[model samples]
Target: MSTETKEKYEKYYVPEQSPWPIVGAIGLFLLAFGGGNFIQQTTGKYGNEGSWGWLIFLVGLSIILYMMWSWWRDTVRESMGGLYSSQMDRSFRQGMLWFITSEVMFFAAFFGGLFYARTMVMPWLGGEGNNAMTHALLWPEFIPSWPMVETPAGDTTTAMGAFGLPAINTAILLTSSWTLTIAHHALIKGNRNTLINYTVITALLGVIFLCLQAYEYYEAYHHMGLTLGSGIYGSTFFMLTGFHGLHVTIGTIFLIVLSIRCASGHFKPENHFAFEAGAWYWHFVDVVWLFLFIFVYIL
Candidate 1:
């Protein structure tokens, strides 16, 4: 009986070893180092052109994008060939869950730094704690306040208004999330036309959000004097929202690919783990943007 069950049910399918993980690590290292230097140069801190930094960063990004496309294409082929069993699906779901959990922790660290800077660090530097000597010795005239536009070095820049472009971007992301939800339902109901249309609309919304963000950045740098060197406020503002924008870009690409797959009849009504995973990621991106809008923008 056991032999018969084993033969009928088929054994688990393990994937072959791949070199993408190491390649991806190398890409990330280059991206981090190059991107940091690129920022410094572009913000006038280094007074250099940042040509090499930009080149290395672009190369790293291209490699990462290529690896992702190739890896996902192979996975899609294997999935379409019916190589994945129920157990494999469960494993994929668990993997996605853990990945999202790690992403949450990643953002938590940034948020923690922001909170520490605002509540504890600034106050201590302003003579609020027992270290009056420290405050007087460093910046005796410093008065810690929200929307800190003045740095301790006497440098000043403008703080962006929360209700202008940021509010509009928030609305755009929220609508994209709704459109994606509709696309998910259409996929589940086997409405291919609606699925493709809604997914495309969602991707378009993501693009529009990015464009507005770009324009906002231009306004910050060109007119408002806000930049990477505009002190902690500008740094945190860009870091939080910049990473969110990158995630939105990735999500937009994911939706575009999923739309193409939908047109090619890749997902079925009941067995669409890939579609589910993309939807999960899109929704996560939406939620993160909401938090960013509230904490980084409105607050």
Candidate 2:
């Protein structure tokens, strides 16, 4: 190492300005606009816009995804080219920490709403607490029940059983967590082949889990007649499990990327922040699934 290189404290590399952020913002705007119109038109059936909203939504989604891929690809190239210093690495780690924290709070908001609706809103409608007048004025026949399968307006749907498909999905996720840990250990031991094999297995398990969830959704909609219109049960069920499934999808992609990078020898035993970050995210996704299994499904 050159003495001059070692002594250069002010050599922080600053990347040039990029237009990806603005592009991403435009993508988000289009998505929100199209999504709102699509939902309203589809659910209410009162709009002149039929399928154009959906097409616009897809375009926006594609744009956002392309932006993410390009931005991250450039960042990865920079890191691999050794343009990042120790300070930059710290910044990356901190950024990941804050991002994960934000995700946690996002899920917390949904769970909080779920609990409030289940515990308070339903109860108040069923003559509990000081809401007897509310019960009398609105939904006089509304019965307060945990898993309110029947709506106040007499709509009905079946509650999903916990021990059937959900149990299988839980097992699959747990196994994936184990396989990922094995891969991480193999990486630490410099066993590239084992790492790749186990990581691939983890990704496969994620795929299987998603397939099962999709089938479960089909069963709910087809045979069981459960949907967003079914009641609060369907709403919370989909809200919690649906978002978690999205996370699993993202985590599966993360694992696949890491597996490719591993095959190309992108990580070392001592310096693999990308791999560690992916592992942390996968584990967080797994933990959230566990909570959903217990509270959303079993309870």
Candidate 3:
């Protein structure tokens, strides 16, 4: 082997096989199964008698959380001890990039479902295609529109227009993206104070955006009477936007962690993979929100 490869193998610290991943998988399986049972119970279908699924789900969730915390703590300790070389840093960067790319594709699947439902399914239900009798027998008054004011089931809801808190959130997220870019630039310039200030500001903006989103959800649920059970429109709206909100929450936590690292002088000007990872995640969240604002809310 080459000298560099030999050195890499020498420095690598691979752990023995651990049971955490398999245990975590079992926990997730319980969570999913229990959640399904819980939903059925809520709908007045007493499929499972004692809420055993929910209890199991909660236990599984706790185990998963513990696993993640312990695993990440160990990884951070290893990273801080100078165990990671340049090749390791590159691997981490590439791994994070590909992880974000996978997230993009995940959201893209939802977007695609939305498009297919709006352009094809709704139209076909309204007798636009080969199902003329479908309209005549079922939803004669249904109109195929993007916001889907009236569903085939005769349920109606006012579309959330783009002129309210959503537009404000768009501006907030966009400006935060700019501030985070400035923070990244400051970090590269070795201005730790400026970097911390900008990162803190960006994190605050993320908090504000999350607050605004919570308010928007309240408005939709109470004032607009648009909820996850409203219809297909409501379902799509909540699914896409809810997942994006969750990603924003995660990204904010990532930035907060990076800010703490910066304050502790953990990242140098030359080697700051943790900071870069957080920044890249934040940027990815920003881009996803931009698309959501344009397609889901605005259009």
The candidate that achieves the highest TM-score relative to the unseen native structure = 1
What are the runs in model 3 whose C-alpha is more than 4 Å off?
Answer: 1-10, 15-20, 23-65
lDDT of 1: 0.88
Question: 142-199 in candidate 2: lDDT tens per residue?
Answer: 8788888997678789999999999999999999999999999999999999999999
What would the per-residue lDDT of candidate 1 be over residues 4-96, giving only the tens digit for each residue? 787887568899998888988988888888898799787777679675898889988988898889888989999999898888999999999
Tell me model 3's lDDT, rounded to 2 decimals: 0.82
- TM-scores for all predictions: 0.95, 0.92, 0.86
> What is the TM-score (0 to 1) of candidate 2?
0.92
In candidate 1, stretches whose alpha carbon ends up further than 4 angstroms from where it belongs are 1-3, 7-10, 46-51
**What's the alpha carbon RMSD for model 2?**
2.5
Residue 9 in candidate 3, Cα distance off native in Å: 8.0
Candidate 3: tens digits of C-alpha lDDT, residues 129-224: 688998888878776777876655566687887879989999999999999999889889999899999999999999999999999989998888
What is candidate 3's CA lDDT for residue 131?
A: 88
- For residue 271, model 2's alpha carbon misses the true position, in angstroms, by 1.5
